[model samples]
Target: MRRVERALLSVSDKTGLIDFARGLSELGVELISTGGTAKALADAGLPVKNVSDVTGFPEMLEGRVKTLHPMIHGGLLADRSKPEHMSKIAEHGILPIDIVVVNLYPFAATVAKPGVTWEEAIENIDIGGPSMVRSAAKNHAAVAVVVSPSSYDGVLNELLRNDGKLEAETLKRLAGEAFAHTAAYDATIAAYFAKKLGEETESILPAKLTLSFEKAQDLRYGENPHQKAAFYREAQGGQGVASARKLHGKELSFNNIYDLNAAYNLVQEFAGEKDPTAAIIKHTNPCGIAVSTTLADAFTKARAGDPISAFGGILATSRPIDAATAELITGKNTFFEAIIAPGYDEDAFKILTEKKQWGANLILLEAEFGAEAAGENIDIKRVSGGILVQTEDKHAVGRADLTTVTRRGPSDAEIADLLFAWKVVKHVKSNAIVIAKDRQIVGVGAGQMNRVQSVRLAVEQAGDKAKGAALASDAFFPFADGPEAAGIAGVTSIIQPGGSKKDGETTEMADNYNIAMVFTGHRHFRH
Candidate 1:
């Protein structure tokens, strides 16, 4: 037999409560509510029977003991189709509830405030709310559970179409969401307690840490066509391009993700600075990065890094996109996948969107991510299940750390460029080599099998531009062969973290070639 329509309404958030109650009333569904909900329904000019009226007990202990009674649970939990459960409910004069609309107290919000006391936080934890939700979810075969305000409209539509009845499949899906909601709540509570009182700062036991992240979006594909991938975002705040607001464009691709991350990390160094800069990224590395008085000039120098790679790359700037810079970018036939900045000029948008094929490929985002200090630890990875985690390589080649091993000293301009190259090399995969001229990348050799080969490859890519350029290595030169390769290719100055046993040999080789060299006393081996 079909059960009579009834609903149990208990909610702390009163958003759309009156309208929801009124809709249920229009369907001739009896509303049984506890405490505040009953008062709210009564104020809305709708009839509501108090929970105490059905349970036959008055609310005690300042409303804490309102809905934790046997009569309410028995009616909500009884199987309506079973004759024995129905007979018992009839004998006890209990009215079955076909729907439950509930939302928990604001425990997370209460504790989020500054200087909140433990007593206040404990008081906000609702016991009866979660219990009622669980009972309704467990017996969803005969009841509809509505926990989210977002689901209120859908539930109302279902009732409007079916005359206050819901399909079995819809009920089951709502129940699943209810369980997930409670599980996440309990996990947050457990993590908070362990962080505040139960756990020590440094314990080296084999601890299992489960991080829960929700899906941000589904990507077009993974790094390769055969692989599958999706993007997940942290629930808490700290993020970069992962949390950026996409003002325009289609879904981001795998290559777009790689380049955008690199560009985003680089531009953060200059975020909000009066001196503007531009960074162009390709294949998870910086092909062009430069700072200038104007963003257009910076982009010009940055694009000179590797024009071939920049053809289909991603661009990020520290300032707003101006008309001149936008014209410079849009005038080219180069196929850029994405562009991000603090904002865009109206004329700039006009030029980009007016193009024939611009709408399909171009993506623009608004983000202002500033450079923050790195964490104490860093993590690196390798193929075949190899992992490395340690303190970050924060050592930079300061002027005091340099030891002039060569007879010829570097010019002041050469020294400045050498420092710039050194900074760029650290972020590249090892064994890394970088060539710089006038504070911009000329050629970068990264992820090579050997140090000498990486140096040779960087110089080869630099070609005729290797003359008068400064070079930086991720680690110390193991032998003089690396310097020899650079010397033959016309590199003038070099910087490296020198702890090598063959340091004297390399110094002699640099002196023989009349090239200036400095030992930075630090290494930045990424892998």
Candidate 2:
């Protein structure tokens, strides 16, 4: 290949730009730029050539038509290895561009603004920049394409080491990075357009789907030790578990991430509530959950609901961890795989680190996520050959949304406990049952084969504590057996989504047992 001679430079992110440009200049490579980039280089006392000078055509159309001329593209796309192609470019007075350094406009950020207009979003969709990047990438056999400032140092080092020329492998790798950059850019634009169309047409979910994600970490293993796994995150991450910052402890595992996500999502239902909430999760199912006046009280009560199952489980809470809660977590043979909260006090962090045996090894994360409606939330699952996509389950019910289907109505305390149990049950697996008293989860049965079995399991777990507690089922009881089992266990108030044909039987059973039952008209199935 030919030695590196001329490199085009146009980037929105100027990070490491001047140093890279100076390195290229020291290697005797010419620098070509457009618009503000050229002005910046000249202001910095670096030699640079304007695209207008190279193309003999000034930039027009509000600076949108800068480098779309044949002079620029021909330099990037000409086949340097072919004598005929080289001759044709030379005949057209177009010098070959050995390197391309570009980064597109910030389309994603523009659309993410609170009150951005369509004209502003459209204006940020770069045209000439992508065209030049594609041209350089398509001719990677003879040209080097770079679309990120992160790649600048490596490119300059290689050029300095190889006497101003890039290796073929380096060229190929840069080509891949270039294409990925443009692809991610286009995907963001596509998403913005999809949002605009939905706003205009009163519809959501686009005809085509485009997504971009970056690897967060490589896990030791997946659900099992034999399987491999890696965690990926969105390019422009919103607040959640994946975007949470690890404040302390060991690396998270595959199962830890799943359980953390489950626990975090469950606690989000209580966001902005006056009382703090806590949920202890194992295998993506909550063993216990509770809301209380203080964060420490909530944690103690949630763990007390099922202390046996809480061993080595993941805990998620809505409020910051205080010193009192840290004391309870590290007291008396207590162990947890991870704990996530919005923040941690200095004393709490110190206490947990010094008191717990596995404190240094515990995964602690801080994330800020709250409940909001009408978000573009999507849930995806992978199958054998494809993926299943649907809207995330954000359905919520209130007291006014419920109908008392039994002869008796629930008391104020029972109503509060029932609502709390309902929120927890919505995150549980299908055929789920949750029993709670005084806003504390006493028992939970999830992923059972039948609704009756779930009820039996939850009642058994709750034992004598099931008496006078509120029971919440994710869905309506298919038969009266579920209510009969809860009734026999002394459950006083029950809440469920009532759509079954045998709803009358369930209601009759509740009435006979003097159990007040309410129907939410909504189902939450998380299978």
lDDT tens per residue, model 2, 308-410? 9999999999999999998888889689999999998999999877754788898899998574423466688999998787877878888899899999999
True-structure lDDT of candidate 1:
0.80
TM, every model: 0.79, 0.96
Task: Kindly list the per-residue Cα lDDT of model 1 for residues 201-303, writing each as its tens digit.
Answer: 5422123332335577788789987888888754332447766788788788776776787787677655645778788877777777777788889888888
What candidate 2 gets wrong by more than 4 Å, as runs, is 371-374
lDDT of every predicted structure (CA atoms): 0.80, 0.89
Q: What is the C-alpha RMSD of each candidate to the true structure, in Å?
A: 4.8, 1.6
True-vs-predicted CA distance for residue 516, candidate 2, Å: 0.6
Specify the poorest-scoring 10-residue window by lDDT in model 2.
369-378
